[model samples]
Target chain A: MSVLAFPPPVESEAAETLRAEVRAFLADANAARTPLERAESWNGFDREFSRALGRRGWLGMTWPKEYGGHERSAFERYVVVEETLAAGAPVAAHWIADRQSGPTLLRHGTEAQKRAILPRIAAGECVFCIGMSEPDAGSDLAATRARAERQGDGSWKVNGTKLWTTYGHEADYMILFCRTSGTPADRHEGTSQLLVDMRMTSGVTVRPIHDLMGQHHFNEVHFEDAVLPPDALLGTEGQGWAQVMGELAHERSGPERFLSSIQLLIELIGALRGSESLAAQAAVGRLFAHLVTLRRMSRGVAALLEAGDDPTTHAAIVKDLGATFEQELPDIARSLVDEEPDLRSTSDFAAVLAYTMMAAPAFSLRGGTREILRGIIARQLGLR
Target chain B: MDDVSSIIFESAQRLLSDLSERVSAGRPMADCERADGWRQIEEMGLPFALMSEAQGGLGLSDAEAFELVRICGRNVVPWPLVDTMLANRFATQGGAAPAEGPIDTLGELTAEQKERAALARAMQMAGALDVILVMTISHVQERSQFGRPLAKFQAVQHSLAVLAGEVAAGQAAAEHAVARLARGGAAATLAIGIARARIGEACSKAAAIAHQLHGAIGYAREHRLHLYTTSLWRWRDEYGTQTWWTRQVGREVLAAGPDAFWPAVTGA
Candidate 1:
């Protein structure tokens, strides 16, 4: 059994070269971008920009070369992700696909399934959305009522609605979770995952759900008799609970969790450069300290992942702490700046403040609610 | 560095496990005080890890030291580990043999005998110092309000979080510095400054909070918790407060420019 240990810090030449290459790419991209001249960080999703990243072989830096990946070390990918998030690049378009979906496919998808989709994802030509949440099921993922029934033609008919689907309307496909057998009464035992081609499906409907900022990032997706090939099943039927739990490990812990609001912090610090107030300095120092702790913890998780360890408990810890920091951005910013918080203002400060305030609520709600995450932690500690 | 750190951490973890078991076995807190704790740490060669091979100690770096300190923080291993490490670095920089036993430098003294005298006075005034390492920035007099202590205020609560952050950062920086000094770098000065600032901040904040929370009772020695809080306040102001180190960091940063700020802070 391999015990989890911190991987030696990336000191090899290849790692350094990758870091330099990524830094150069981010510098150029940050310079060229204009109209959407805002630092949306994790929220900003641009398909063209994602494709550009793909062209540079950055989107799938750590998958097998057979699937159009560079097969780089996870540490190298760690550098790229950190730099990208820190630079506030528009990464949401390919974030889910690159981070978890592609990996999940590699682990569970059949050869035909792999050959058909992995390369396109690696190339950033195809975008994917998670079809996990249903109208009734949020954290209770096993409670999804989306049903898939076997047809005489060796295919499956999927029917139900998924809510809060990020980029559902824009995604080419969705790695969806649905019931293959039994009802919610069976919960984990009968659920399974399927990769559905949104373009070819005729029964699918998508409607944008405007967030507080009026952004159409999330949507309500409906599937009425959507036909999927038998091969669309990601893994064996009735094994989705295990598959998704593994995938959640990937989703929960990452540089993105703690870094979403870092750009705003950088901007805030820049504006406070000449200020001599003790409160402002102390507040900034406090934020920096918390940031350091979050980074250390998140890096520890990454090290665990590199060591091929299950770090679900550690991931939950990072998510909870990260959400707290992200949610506190506006309050911290307000205390630092002398001006009023306004979303519509043309100033960069106003724009970032507005974006952060609007985006902050979802920080906890998106991946997992604070209550849910804490419950997981409590369970891990055997307190529940 | 990686191998050495892994070995040290594993050993430290084992030691902590044993200590925790003992604590759970109804061992009194005072029974495991500085003398025994320092011996255990010394036997583990932690102070040696804080020094360089050139200085007759195990060679390490800031990053390695940080890893050690992080583990220590997570376990909440109560001892003057950070303080002793700071004292060792100070002694090494002064071209003196690193102190072999527990040494708590008095914060309110300067000359060696005076420092010893101050520690003695502190022991007389309050209690004993396993090792008193005095710092240079001692407050002239206690600040008071309306014939009452000035430590009580609603603003103090708001400041505690910031105070904790500063202390954490300072301790982190000190750990980093000792690692650098072990590798034979001129980081002892920086480490001392950070240690002074961090200790002072922790002390003052703890004092303010303790006084506010305890009210007039904090002034009474019978309140045992006050000992911990007051010792922190007195010791914090002994060497240097936040104001002193803030100016020092400012001077260093101004001389180096914004580009060097991160490298300086991170000891890169």
Candidate 2:
């Protein structure tokens, strides 16, 4: 009956300094963005904004400076990320790249791959999207049927579809996880990740998938024997399953996981201000309590990751519980306030509430679904 | 996880484990049992965990003291160890010394005191959930229904899973509060306020689910589940109810204004 332990996040002088710097930067940068746009939070894409962050060396914060990184600590990067997410900064352009792709590449990429790609990622010039979920393989990523065959010329040719690919159309590259060998029955066997250059590839096509929210943030990316050079393989051949599993820690541990509905929360606070409603106060306070706990858990994982702990189960716990909070935020807001959520409303609170309500459904679905994460958690608990 | 902390924690864990086994066997905390438990905890030096060496205390780190509380919570120790530590912390800040007794006077819980008490209570709830969860899981595994062990039911497993999530939430909130208090940051007060509010909110759902999953046996006086659930109900409203802390935290957050809200929380 072992329970999960989330240690207090270790304080750092560097993280404190970076936090102030990032907050100041966000205040200035987000001055022009409306509450509706800020409500979009991490999903809001802005390439130039990403570039501005890159100039400040925030994009590749924890990476080594020789590859255009700032050589900062993970805690320092955490501060920047939490500040950016809380301020509702448009970080979509460089988020996936900075969060997982670059780290994955840094850990497993060849020297050439790291040199060619990590610097651009650090500069926020190169945007990346994940190529994990296929139409038939979402949470069951091992069910991936996307095949990458080795050509006689030593290059690879990929053919399959990747669904729910966020920023697929705008991405400069993708860390494509595909079956290098073995059947779908093999589950996790003979998989490999490809560092596919979207711009250089000719047979790839990205079609936008409008979500329930009428947003074009997601896409269906197709590959038709898309050719990749010999160097495209990340880590080892036939080890993509393990490699991708290792990278889930990076994907799951960020502050962005829990802060998705922060704009709505901020707006809710404004609407509830000076109100004599005890119910409203309690509701908002409950949400804030969840937020603080989630942040602590998330930050604890960040610190654990910094200390070179795997924290895979810890990360899953954060994502699962964090999504629950994110999805619940809008519902709590709707209940506490009388305002009808209207996406096009002139009221900042209503507009943000609308945006949050529409986006809330995706919280548990993205990164990983609640059921899948719970299964992982149950397994971690030795229950399955 | 330092050497001294681990040693202290191990000793406390052993004592608590023994006490927990006895309580499980005894079904509830008798007055004599409660008094003995307090003596043991005081002898373990937990009350002075946060007090300085000059004050004849170990003065362990806040994280270590919180860890001890978490362990005690997990076991449902039925002692006022956390309360004593709170009293000691208060007294160390130039207040009246804890009254001379096996336990110190907790005094009237101010907003900060209430929040601290809430965090301690939250930890207890988390611990109690852990005990109930294990008990329920064991019961479901052993007790048969419909020609199969109750654990075979998907509904039972899912309910237990939900219980696990609640326990996790409570534990996370308590730890977060303790961590913030340990840091003594400007937002520490607000952080504790949020922690108490959230944990208090979770109390009902956690208690209800545990009882529901346990069935009639859970409500029985001899079953031992009542020991935890009843304590949870009592402590949940002790310092401040979720409503009290929520309004307190919400008012502070609102007063800070919308623009300052993000920085207030993040910086905390």
Candidate 3:
């Protein structure tokens, strides 16, 4: 059996410098946000706060300066992400764009597309969404029946429905993956990624899909004969399957994978502050231990990505372990204290507890489900 | 993975593999003199690998030392080699003469030494976890019950999955500690605390699941599985217990105030 290997740990020289800058900015930016607002985690969207981060050049720290980025190292960008997630920064507006979309575009986008979209994304004015999962396809994305037919003048007509598109209703663009040239038997071969401009595209509809927590962060997008120019295709035609796999590596291994419940954890620590609950103290310590381990692994994956390695299996492990920790935080908090969870309670602890209990169930399902992740890991172990 | 570490690890692995074969032939840990193994390790100069050149050592990196510890764990080495390695570093740093022979046991330990040793122990636990998991997976595939191989049972597969998770967590925790020690930064102590506590916790879950998966045979004195699990039990309590490290982390964070909680968690 092949064992998993994480690259040796890395401590960047830029960690402290960038950490201080991010911390100083977060202190004032988060001054008025409530515990519940912070409880929203990265799902908390604030346009002004995102714009402010862009102004400070934190949005695309690893990209080139000519693209309106700060031209910082990946480690510096990692520091920004870790600090932002820990403080529960309202980064959802630019989160998808900055995390995976921008990176993917930089890797495979046409030069013209990069010039037009990269600067706006870096400025936090352009938000992006993934358009991979369709009504008939989720984890098994190859089952995608969405078709793009080539039209006159080398353009294309796209028709399909994408589901569970996070921030799609508010997004400015989508990296749409659809079938271009082969039958379903071709599976991964016929797929291609198209850059769909949400603002300018006609016959496209976005319907909000409120989560169980009553939050409208997800959407269902319908592309009814949406017309796109030839330059819209990312990378090459029939290479979207490979391209998306590379993008998934970025999506799966970020600090956001594990820090989704930091607000609950912070609130628990505050509630038990100076109390004589050894169990609570021990629980908090254990949670931090798991978190620290996950962060190291996540950072190791970041290093691998920065080194231009394909860490597909490594990223899967990080996400699976991260999901376990995120889903378990609320339960551990509950076992340590003896209070009823109440979202409206005067106690911030109870409110966070209530909120986290509702949100924890989605931690495993959101990025990539636990089942899909485990299958990948099992295959990596040579079990399949 | 460097030239120095690769050369040292290769030689040590060969020597340790020979020792493992001897132990596998039927000798228990109690029968093996601690000094005999220490002499071989000392001759290889592994205990002094992390000391400075002026102190007569190769002055290798912490990552090399960590790999050595993991190798020792994988072989189920009976001696307290990790403790002695740390003693050499501590003694040299304290301006005391480095011990020439196998160190019996350390006297009092500094906080840094304790944390470092705890990380080594965690790596040992990770190594033990690998052996235990491999053994159990094989056992479940071969052993049969209810007219079918044990591996055919859904419950057994799920149990094995949980054990794998614990193993993964332990390795992650130990690697994090290794990285922290290599950096030698201010956050090293906290990283060590987390490693000891998290790996210690994983050891418990791993041990139970391993024993359960192996059935009654795992507990037998004659079975090789006990060598790994028993060492895990000993290592989990040594250096620092999960409760001790946890309490230390808790007290430190709480004293920093609620506002510092996030920063403390992130080690920023």
Q: Best candidate per DockQ, number?
A: 2
lDDT of 3 by residue, A67-148 (tens): 7788887788888888888887788999999999999999999889888989988888888999988888888889988888
RMSD of each: 10.0, 3.3, 3.5
Clashes of each: 16, 2, 0
Worst 10 residues of 3 chain B by lDDT: B24-33
The parts of candidate 1 lying over 4 Å away from their true place are A1-13, A32-37, B1-102, B106-268
Candidate 2 CAPRI-style tier: medium
For candidate 3, give the lDDT of residue A230: 81
- Return the interface RMSD of model 2: 1.9
| Candidate 2: residue A6 lDDT (0-100) | 75
Give me the runs in candidate 2 sitting further than 4 Å from their true place: B1-9, B24-71, B76-119, B136-158, B182-188
* Preferred candidate (DockQ higher): 1 or 3: 3
Residue-level lDDT of model 2, residues A113-181, one tens digit each, is: 999999999988999999999989988899999999999999999999999999999999999999999
TM-score, each model? 0.73, 0.90, 0.89
Q: How high is each candidate's interface RMSD, in Å?
A: 11.0, 1.9, 2.4
Ranking by DockQ: 2, 3, 1
- Candidate 3, superposed: residue stretches over 4 Å from native: B1-5, B25-63, B83-116, B133-165, B178-188, B208-222
lDDT of 3 by residue, B134-237 (tens): 88878887899999877767677656666776787788887777776755755887777788888888889888998998888887877888888888888888
Instruction: For candidate 1, write residues B78-117 as lDDT tens digits.
Output: 4555456656755675687887775655243333323222
By summed lDDT, the worst window of 10 consecutive residues in model 2 chain B runs over: B95-104
